[model samples]
Target: MKWTDINDIAIELADSQPDTDPLKVNFVDLRDWVMALPGFDDDPKHCGEKILEAIQQAWIDEVA
Candidate 1:
């Protein structure tokens, strides 16, 4: 999944880190966690603050 696949990434993150809070995650760790997700395949350079914020919001929604 690429950075554009925001919902998918959020789902994966929600499932992988059920105990973690998305709001508390810093961008650096969030980026690393996203990269570490299985099936995640994208150029790291493609990601930016906007994408990270979207992902974090999506993850929060997923778990909610």
Candidate 2:
């Protein structure tokens, strides 16, 4: 999944880290976590603040 696959990434994160709070996640760690997810395949440099923010928001929504 690429950075554009926001909902898919969020779902994976929610399932992988059920105990973690998305709001408390910092961008650096969030980025790392996203990269670490299985099936995640994208250019790291393609990510930016907007993409991170969207992913974080999607994760929060997924958990909610």
Candidate 3:
């Protein structure tokens, strides 16, 4: 997968919940879809390690 692959989280959530309301999807479904995307496929963070690092460092940062 390309390193620059982009994602439309909202759209993916909606598509996965075609029969149900998008806003009402279960957390697991949304999380799974987002994680499955190529954009997030190569994520270096595992089990909140990176997030915990960022939080411990307490530095201002940007996602993209």
* Winning candidate number (TM-score): 2
True-vs-predicted CA distance for residue 63, candidate 2, Å: 0.4
Where is model 2 more than 4 Å wrong at Cα? none
Which has the better TM-score: candidate 1, or candidate 3? 1
Candidate rank order under lDDT? 2, 1, 3
Q: Which stretches of model 3 miss by more than 4 angstroms?
A: 1-7, 38-64
Candidate 1 lands at a TM-score of 0.97
lDDT of each: 0.97, 0.99, 0.39
lDDT of model 1 at position 30: 98
Q: Pick the candidate with the highest lDDT.
A: 2
Model 3 steric clash pairs: none
Q: Model 2 — which ten-residue stretch has the worst lDDT? A: 14-23
lDDT of 2 by residue, 1-64 (tens): 9999999999999999999999999999999999999999999999999999999999999999
lDDT of 3 by residue, 1-64 (tens): 2222222434443454446543444445544555665445545334243432332222112111
lDDT of 1 by residue, 1-64 (tens): 9999999999999999989999999999999999999999999999999999999999999988
Steric clashes per prediction: 0, 0, 0
Sum up the clashes in candidate 2. 0
